[model samples]
Target: MQINVSTRHGHLSSESRARIVRKVEKLERYFERLTSIEVTVDLEHEESPTVDLRVSAEHKHDFVATGRASTLAASLDVAIGKLEQQLRKYKEKVQNRHRTSGRGAGEVPSLAEREAPDVDAEDEEI
Candidate 1:
């Protein structure tokens, strides 16, 4: 998967960018079909930075999360956590969609196998 890290209102050092990329790459473990990841850091407010994480997966809408914290690392962590939960939930849904509805083979008889009661015989006996 491709990871693109971009910043807004500020610049990040090479070491910081590398660290962010490393941490973001771990998200692929949660969803193997991920196509790309985009990380955006907004430093408009020096004291509190906001991190926006967007993950793209095969045959799925983009998963997005935003986190604001005192530091860039903390914000990124928060965003990653949110994205992890989203990916997990989506993966579970996709897996479950293919499963049969908890019904075992021959547990219930088909309509054609059911016999109609003898109404005329019951009336004669009454």
Candidate 2:
């Protein structure tokens, strides 16, 4: 997956960028088709650091998560956790779609098929 890390209103050290890459790479285990990941770190305020994470996958909707904390690593961790939850939900939905696509081995009768006909037996006058 392609990873792009950028800092807004501040400078990020090389070590910090590497750490972010390592953490983001772990997401691939949840979703293999991930095409690209974008991480934006905003350090305008020294006390609070904000991290914006966006992940794109093949033939699927993109996932985005935002987190704010006292440190950059903490914020990244929070955002990553949110993204992991989204990926798991997406995986479950896709799996269920395939599982429900067709009928099972046994055929179940519908309500109309289960009901008896309403024909009257004593209709000799007709």
Candidate 3:
């Protein structure tokens, strides 16, 4: 997946940038088909930093999470946790949908079998 990191009103240290990249890369374990991830860090105050994460996946809506904390890493951790929850929830929903959509194998009769019953009906009185 492609990850783009940007900072607003502050500069990101190389070490911090590397840490963010590593943490974001771990998200692939949750969703294999993720297409891209955008990370935006905004320093609105000297002590509090806000982190925004947007993750795009194939055949699914984007997942977004935002966090504010005293440290950039803390904010990022909170946002990543939120994203993981969303991914888990979405995966459950999709699995449940597919599971509930069809009858169990061998429970449904073929079209020709159903028609055979109708053909025998003409030999008896309704």
Candidate 4:
């Protein structure tokens, strides 16, 4: 997956950028076909150091996650956690739908067997 890191309203350090790359790289273990990710880090100039982590990935559909924390690491953790939940839910839903769509061999109706009509009740019409 290609990860693009951007910082707004603050000077991003080399370590901070590397941290984001490392964290996003780990997502491949869960979803290998990830297309891209965008991470935005903002440091509060007024009070505490607040960071926001946002991630976007491509699969059967687009998945997005966002979270804020006092630290960049914590924020990234929450974002990844949310993404994991989404991927799991997507997988389960697809599996459930596929399972429900299948019909067993017993459910098949042969043309002759289905067209044979009721011999015993043919005399008594409904």
**Ten residues in sequence with the least summed lDDT for candidate 1:** 96-105
What's the true lDDT of residue 67 in model 4? Answer: 61
TM-scores for all predictions:
0.79, 0.81, 0.79, 0.66
Mind giving the per-residue lDDT tens digits that candidate 4 earns over 1-126?
Answer: 567888777877899789878877887676555677777666754243444444455544677777676677777788878877877777678777887687865687789999898887977774
- Which 10 residues in a row give candidate 3 its minimum summed lDDT? 117-126
**C-alpha root-mean-square deviation, each candidate:** 5.9, 6.2, 6.1, 6.4
List per-prediction Cα lDDT, in the order shown: 0.92, 0.92, 0.90, 0.71
- Tens-digit lDDT string for candidate 1 (69-109): 99989999999999999999998998877664677667887
The residue pairs that clash in candidate 2, if any, are none
Candidate 4 residues lying further than 4 Å off, grouped into runs, are 45-60, 104-126
Question: In candidate 1, how many Å is residue 84 off?
Answer: 0.3
Candidate 2 matches the true fold with a TM-score of 0.81
Instruction: Encode model 3's per-residue lDDT on 51-109: one tens digit a residue.
Output: 99999999867999998889898999999999999998888888888976877766888
93 in model 3: Cα distance from truth in Å?
1.0
For candidate 3, list the clashing residue pairs, or say none: none
The candidate maximizing TM-score is 2
